[model samples]
Each structure stands twice: as structure tokens, then as C-alpha cells.
Target: MAEHTAARPRGRPPRADREQVVHTALRLLGEVGLDALTMRRLADALGVQAGTLYGYFPTKRALLTAMAEAMMSGCQDAGENAATPREQVLALARGLRTALLAHRDGARVYAGTHAVGPNTLGFSDTLIGALRQAGVDAAAAVQTALLIVHFTTGHVLEEQAATGADPELLTEIDDLHQAIAQGEYPQLAETHKELTGTDFTQLYERGLQLLTSDVP
Candidate 1:
């Protein structure tokens, strides 16, 4: 009798890799938002077993970190043609904000992840170099860069959060306006327009200016 080899199992083929997993996860993030972008969901989207993802990203946080890094790609290039250190810093800040605003919940996706990937590192190095060139000390330059990043990320988080202006948020704004009009808070009443302003673009630019004003 002829020897017979066992047939290969008929099932879903393994098709996911690190890049495809991150790419699909990011797509799912945009589609369903971060909270709903689970490993099982990603695997299902990729037509693979949930355990397959662990081979590419050991944990959810690892996957998120990779996604964050991918989102930050080419951000530092925005400062390439900047004329001054201040301009370079501002360019980088604006670039970061733009990057964070590119996807739904992008800021939340990047907020707490410690991504040491090339793109993130390049952005940090370029920002710090600009700060140092503007006469800031080594430690202070690093700290200032962190402050700028924190401010940019935090501002983008609020900006993204306010994108739809839900009913509850509108009600809260109305309540604040009424409360300020009561005269119990004189200062708030005096600056009520600024307090209730919805011009995020203006606010973001002003904030960037203030953050970089002392640079040079």
C-alpha cells in the first residue's frame, strides 16, 4: 500500500502580520472608536483567530503604542523649512495637533502611550533641538518640550471631544453663561465672551504663541 500524507486542515488562513494588524486596528479605531476596538474585534476583522494578534502585539497596550507611533509618522517634517527656532517649535506643535486631529479620538489614542518609535523620537529630538537653539538650557529644553507636547495633546483632546457639541455640553455652556450673568462671579462675567468662546482654532494658535513666546 502507498504511504499517504495527512491533508492540511481546511480552515481560515493566517494572514495577519504586525503592520496589517496595526493598520486594521487603526481602521477599526476610526470606525468604532477606541473603546470598541478590541483584540477579538480586530482579529475578526482580519479573519484570524484572536490568539493570532498576540503574535504581533503581545498586549492591547502594545498594539495601541504601535498605532500611536504609526500616527506620528512624518510629523517632524513640518518644521523642515521653518525660518527660526520659534517658528520651528511652532511648526512642530501645529504638526502634532494636525496629526492628532487626523483620526477620530486620535489624541486619546496617543495620550498615555510611551512610544519610542522613530517618528516619535524624531519629533522629540527636533523640538528639543529647536528649544536649545533658542537659548534654553538642556534640562529646561527637554522640560519645555514636554510641556508643549502636553499642552498640544491636552488641547487636541478637548478639541476632538467638542467636535459634535452634544446637547448636554450645550446645556452646560448655557448654565455657565447664566451663572456668570448672575454677577456672583464678577471676573467671569467680565470675560464671559472669552470663557464661552467656541473658536478652537484661535484658542489653539494663541496657546501656541504663549507657549513659545519666551523661546526667543
Candidate 2:
């Protein structure tokens, strides 16, 4: 061993490039919240050195933007699918739910980020196109998609927040049921099961049916 040489840093130097690095960084953002995602962590996740990540994402804000874009890409892919507009709308709702559920704190990550990514806009195009194909008027069709997205996101937020299906809410319902059985609330007691029980999945599907049923 003669002369000791230092190992050179890996990855490209910072250039005015965007797409590839943005996409990779966004994937990590979708997995972990922006605050939790660090350059070193991204490098570890990407199997590259921290230096390489810096070349792509100069700062955390830049990285956050990339994540927002990645999350919306699903709509882009959905638009290309052969399914009908109604099906596509429902698919997007389910897809949003799936994506939010995929990573920890997903909904929060997307909550205030104003990312109008192509993938998201693509899904909107598909939803509107399919809705038009199905005879839903332009305005209503747009509103319908917005409603679905809003509800889906809100539902996911609650889903992730609950420790276990919201025990307090369930306990309150139980109290109501007890009051009903004691004849303090006869009509409510008569329909206690119906009131106290819910199948959110079926409810979500039913909501979709009610919303998109304008097609005939």
C-alpha cells in the first residue's frame, strides 16, 4: 500500500435537469412524508449515494414537488385504460384510496401540496371524457369527479387517523342502542342495528352508483 487516495463522490453534478430525479424523489415522498424524507434516506432507498440525489433534487421543496407529481400519475395511467368513464371514475376513487393507504401519512403529505401534476390532470381528462360519453352533462360530470376525489381523500384521512375503526364513535352508538332497548327511544331501538352498523365499502360503492347513475 503506497499512496492513499480518497474515494470520489458518486452521481452527476447539479445540472438544469428535472424529470428522472423528480420521479425517483417523488416515489420516496409518496412512501414517507416530506419531513421524514431526507437526502441520505432517499439515497439509501434508491441504492445510490447522497451526492446523486443532490444532483436531482437540490432541496427538500424541490423533492416535495416531485412526490406530488408521482402521486397524480395514476390518473394518467387510468385515462389510457379501456374501461368506461363511470368505471374509470370509480377506479380513480379506489386508486386514490389505495395510494393514500400505501404509505404512512400519505393523505397528509398530499393535503396542502398544490401539485397539478400531469398524471392527475390526465385522470381528470379521462373522468370528464367518460362522463361525457355516458351522457352526463359537462358541469355535472366535473362536479361528480371532484366530489368523489374529495370524499375519497377525506375518508382515507379518517381511516388512517382512527386507532381502530373509531372506538369512541362505536361506543356512543352502543349507548344509543342501550337507550333504545330501555324504551327511552323506541323508534331508534327498533332500527338500532341499521343505525349502529355500517359497511363503508358497500356505502362507497353505492355512493358511486348513485352519483354516476345518470348514464342510461
Candidate 3:
């Protein structure tokens, strides 16, 4: 009788590199938004088992940090052509906002994760350097950089939330108008048009100017 051999178990699929993983995650984030872009889903998209991803990114937070870093790549270059320190800071802030708005749920992905990667560090260093060049003290420069970043990210977060024809925002505006008409908010009645304006670009630019007006 011929000897019978047992069938061997299949091994896991080839692992994806860090770059591929991050890019794929970003694509999925755009497709399904952040909450649905789970590790299992990412693995299925990559043709690998979920456990295999842990080899490249030990935790979901690690993967998010990598994605945040990828999104921030080249943001520092925005300030390269700026002629003044204040201009450089504004350029960098604008670049960051643009980067965060590039992907769906982009601001959400970047909001809380602490990405210490080269790109993130480079962006931070460049912004702080510009602030320092503007005659800011080291401690104050770091603080100012943080304040700028916070403002940009927060604005982008609201911007993204107000996308897709934002019915909720419309309702809020309507409610504000009604309140003003009822004489409940005298100041709002006077400036309701500006308060309810949808021109986020103008709003962001104005806020940036206010923040940096004292820089020099």
C-alpha cells in the first residue's frame, strides 16, 4: 500500500509594507470613514489575516499614527517660499488644514493620535523655527505653534463636519435667525449674516490673521 500524506495547512499571505498599509488605510478611510476602517477590514482588503497586520503595526493606534504621518508628509514645504516669518507660519497652518481636508475623516484621524514620525516632527520643527525667527522666545514659540496647530485642526474638524450639504448647520442657522427675530439675541440680530456665513475659507483666513497678528 502506498503511504498517504496529510495535507499541509496554508500559511498567511505575504505581509504588506508600512507604506502600503498606511496608504491602503487612508483609501479605506475615504471610502468608509474612520469608524468602519477596522484592522480586520484592512487585512481583508490587503489579502492578509488580521493578526498579520500586528507585525507591521502592533496596535490600531500605531497604524493611525502612521496614517497621520503620511497625511502630514510635505506639509512643511508650504512655508519654503514664504517671504516673512508671519507669512511662513500662515502658509504652514494653511498647508496643514489642506492636508487634513484631503481625506475623508482626515481631521478625525489626526486629531488625537501622537505621531512622532519624521514628517510630523519636521512639520512641527519648521513651524516652531518660523515662530522663533519672528523673535518669539523658545517657550513662547512652542506654545504659539501648538496654538496654531490646534486652531487649524479644530477648524478643519468643523469644516469636515459641515460638508455634504450640512442640513444640520442650515437648521442651526435658521434657529439662530428665529432667535434673533424673537429679540432673544440682540447682538446676533445685528451680525447674523456674518455669524451664519458658510465661507469657511474667509473665516479661516481671518482667524489665522488674528492669531498671527502679534507674532511680529
Candidate 4:
């Protein structure tokens, strides 16, 4: 194998790291979303030729994976501050949500990429280790960690997607549902107020409890 390089072209600035590339990519992601992020765009943002990015991220999918993994790394100590394993697990789940929510369409970006990278692996290792310390078998520990990841990622995607909907339209739809329920579905009408008031935080906590209930 050959060593990678970041040789700048004439007039280009000197400072560049793999992390810098991801950061620039993330900035563009916030501006234009995942669909518009491309190596050429990133290169233009970073003041480098498109070929420079290939050395760091061979393909667009690879760059996406790196970005997703970078997001995961932000919550590296997900459960580190907690005293008990259960608290650690809860912390990890909550921490992941907070991290993902920090970026625009973060959950969507993360869910779509394959994060078989150091940051993602580190996150998994932390969860698995926490479970193993709590007496779970290795296989079960891995599975539990994955369960938390999958559930939280999916939940956040829906939560973010819901937030992105047109607020006025959402309100109109809610009102329409309530009006219909009042006449046609009396049972639904009775709980329509509560049903429409979806609290993602409460739902996330309950989900964490349910998912980790069997961890012991």
C-alpha cells in the first residue's frame, strides 16, 4: 500500500486534515443537505482539487460514512459520567440523541450511512463494555448495543422528519383529525388532544426504559 498525501496546488492554503475535510463537508451538509454534498463541492469549499479528497475519502459514500461516524464520535463518552451500568446505558442513548440533534438532518444522514469506522466502533465498544461489566454475555451485550443504536436512530429520524413538516399544515391536519374524531371516532376524539401532543423526549425515555429492561 502507498501512503496518502494532501499536496496542495499553487495558491492553496496549507492546513488540511482528514477531520477538516469532514468539517467542511458537514458545513456544506447544513447548507444544502446530504443530496447536494459532493466531492467537488467539498473540494471547492476546502480550496483543494477534487483529487485531494479522494485520498482521504475514496468515494462519496465513504465521505458520508466518515461524516456519520464523526457525529457518533461527538458522544464518545455517552455513558462515561454515570455510576451504574443502567445509568450508563440510558446516558448513552440520550447522549446519542443530543449529538445527532445538533446537526441538520443528522439522524437521516447517520441512518443512511454505513459507519464501520473508528468512531462508530468506539461507541459500540463503550456500550458493549458497559453491558459486559453489568454481567451480560458478549453476544447479548453487542446485540443490546445495536438495539439501542437502531431504536434511537430510527426514533430520531422520525422525530426530526416530523419537525421538518410544515407547521401550519401540521396544525391544520391535527385540527381536521380532531374534528373528524369528534363525530366518527368518539374514542379517538377523547384522546386526540394527548395523541396530537407528541413529546419526543418522553417517548425517547420510555423507549430507552423498554429496550434496556432486559439488560440485567
lDDT of 4 by residue, 4-117 (tens): 998976775554689999999889988887677878888989888888889898988888788898888757587788989878878888988998887788987888676888
Clashing pairs in 4: none
Best model number under TM-score: 1
Q: Candidate 3, residues 71-127: lDDT per residue as tens digits?
A: 999999999999999889999999999999999988889988888888899999999
Ranked by lDDT, top first:
3, 1, 4, 2
TM-score of each: 0.90, 0.60, 0.89, 0.81
Where does model 2 exceed 4 Å of error? Answer: 1-65, 79-83, 163-199
Compared with the true structure, all predictions reach lDDT values of: 0.90, 0.67, 0.90, 0.83
Q: Against the true structure, what is every candidate's RMSD?
A: 3.2, 5.8, 2.5, 7.7
**Each model's backbone clash number:** 0, 1, 0, 0
lDDT tens digits, residue span 30-57, model 1: 8989888999999999999988889888
Residue 180 alpha-carbon offset, candidate 4, angstroms: 5.0
| Superposed Cα RMSD, model 1 | 3.2
Per-residue error for 37 in candidate 3, Å, reads 1.4
CA deviation > 4 Å runs, candidate 1 = 1-12
How do the candidates rank by TM-score, highest first? Answer: 1, 3, 4, 2
